[model samples]
Target: MYIEVGQYLGQDGVWLKNDETRLFIQAFGGMTPEFSRKMRSQTRDYWLNAHWMPHFKAPFSGRMDNDDPEQRAYWQVELLRQAAGTFPCAPAFGPGTDNIPTHGDTANNVWSLASARLVDSGGESYAKAVWHLAGEFELLKYQKTDYLRQGDSSHYMVMTVENNHDDAVPINMAWHTTLGSPFVERGCWLLDNCQQYQVCPQGTEFDTTASLELGARFESLSDIPTRTGGKSDLSLMPGYNGHADFISGVSSSRQLLWSACYNPYYNLVYVSVIPLAQLEDQVSPSFMNYWIHSGGREMMPWADYDGGCDRNYALGLECAIGGSCKGYEWSRENPQLLNKPTYFELAGNSTASFVCINSFFSPEGYGRPITGESQLTEMIEQHIRSLDISFDGLQAR
Candidate 1:
């Protein structure tokens, strides 16, 4: 039952045949322009063209950087590095060049797949697999119980790094997802738990404030927890709420169901030679634990698209082993800058997980955050099972 979802980068992104039974659903090429409007209507349950994203080159458009004939092509091509430009709804996991890899073959540079499966000696599907682009990126692969409901009974998705590159290069990354129209055109909102956030201006003239809002530096899982004041940080819970109220969407106002982003382990080295470096202490890998970072589970509003919907029709759930932004890197020689984010070589045997859960709810009762490590993990697994059952019902048709 494979179908054509949409197009991307002049290519095609097709929906897989067994997507209903697969852990995840991924489209290839670029997200089509018609996706936004279609998603709002219940006349159709699933949308092959359910998402859309603007080209990343818009930020550098008509600038002197585009003046040079060679540079123009470079920027044009490198722009795809931002996953948002290609897939309207996609997450940036792991690490590597924030700007698309201008040095590599831009055609194959983007590898956004829904889910992967590994086979055993008998060639039977053994364990499910998710994508981890390049060695620089590091994300945990887990299931999204609360957000999407479709596809498989073991329905799950976790952003992780595949470490498929040979070069050692600096990298910056985050999940970039542009929900389909009606969601974007009508505008969506966000609710996040992070306490501190910086307006990331990627050299764009457009008022980014309208497009994004960040949370303050968070200290723990709950709204209140042991504040992290010392060098060492503890792995806290993951969750957040939308500020003010839910954003209105075209069809119905939506809210974050459940979200979690945690990296339990990290590989780091704080260089001491750099006198003015902020991270003068030893770069203990423990600090990079997903449970320790500021933004765990969050609910945010997107004032950028359509008008301004607080429901967060489209959301970008992110988790990283290292700081995505440069200034936050505690170590002078930030390990996240490397193409190979860690030496773990997350091949067939490494164990890591990145989980984001979103459940739709009425404006009345708000969602809660998950704190205890064991408890949160268990809850997520249960939600994954629930989603599987729901998807099965849809597939029975």
Candidate 2:
């Protein structure tokens, strides 16, 4: 299987990678022609965009060249020669919370004019496809379904949102994902196991199984522990959420649960699998939620070879619908964040199904994340069931 969608750097993205590992598992963003505004690039393509991360934090912070320390070493050596995955959650998927959300929830309309049509991968994966995005969702005929496949090392996503509109649509899904682990240098953790756990802004609680690292571990920028601990917590420990202030923690398991973000001395991992009752909407009650982008420049430089060191650092994830879901009428008025947001409902015309699993690991397979011996999140679900990229009758344009 050798999959390729079209137009890289120019935007409308999708690429699987094989011509001897081009090193992309999923990709998007075409440099010009308005680039669909999906990740809302501008500010000079957010300083030459390529997953630059919806303006590097919060309603698009855009750091106006952060006091030109040589343009932050020329934009961290051009974001390691062009971003794709480390922009992480600019708008890859939304409704997790930027506060005034709910327009496609975020990511510039959840990847606005984005389009991918490989369909017929129902033929069995080389990169089966069906990706379209355009959701305002007020009246309710909105659309955004991303059904993709390509396994054998994993990448299977099925994000469906169909309202068809008879009226009754207020679900704020989430996948505001992010991971550019490269060499996370022994930081980033979350695996408090789960039957239910909530580790946010210091509202601590666990039931056993813990490994929660990362609340700011810069490695450079003078190793930012919130600038030599002058207060402002940066949060991972030591009292929880602070860096810029925005912390989220969740863990719930009725079985089929997972929420990972690992870099244990650079073993590398990014696994997300949670069936969560086929992803909520039996009328609310979803699970999984781990968001912490830590405001005010925690780590926003990509690495300019030693003198500046590699950058494009990142951290953000959402097993989502795990609630208190930060807004949208306050996650629809709490009831425990509306039973924790993973939303699931279609039955007016028909169509309601959900599944999730996103994987990317490196046990010296050369994707980075070195120094391994297994147990880095259990080898990322053993390469996500050995890339078992099977779609199993997925349909919903």
Q: What is the TM-score of each candidate against the true structure?
A: 0.38, 0.29
Name model 2 segments beyond 4 Å from true.
Answer: 1-152, 175-260, 271-316, 319-323, 326-329, 333-357, 367-397
lDDT of 2 by residue, 42-121 (tens): 35221111122433222221222656676655444332223334222211123334432321332333244345444454
Which ten-residue region of model 1 has the weakest summed lDDT? 266-275
lDDT of 1: 0.27
Q: Backbone collision count in every prediction?
A: 64, 28
In terms of TM-score, how similar is model 2 to the real structure? Answer: 0.29
lDDT of each: 0.27, 0.38
Our tally of clashes for model 1 stands at 64
Number of the top candidate by TM-score? 1
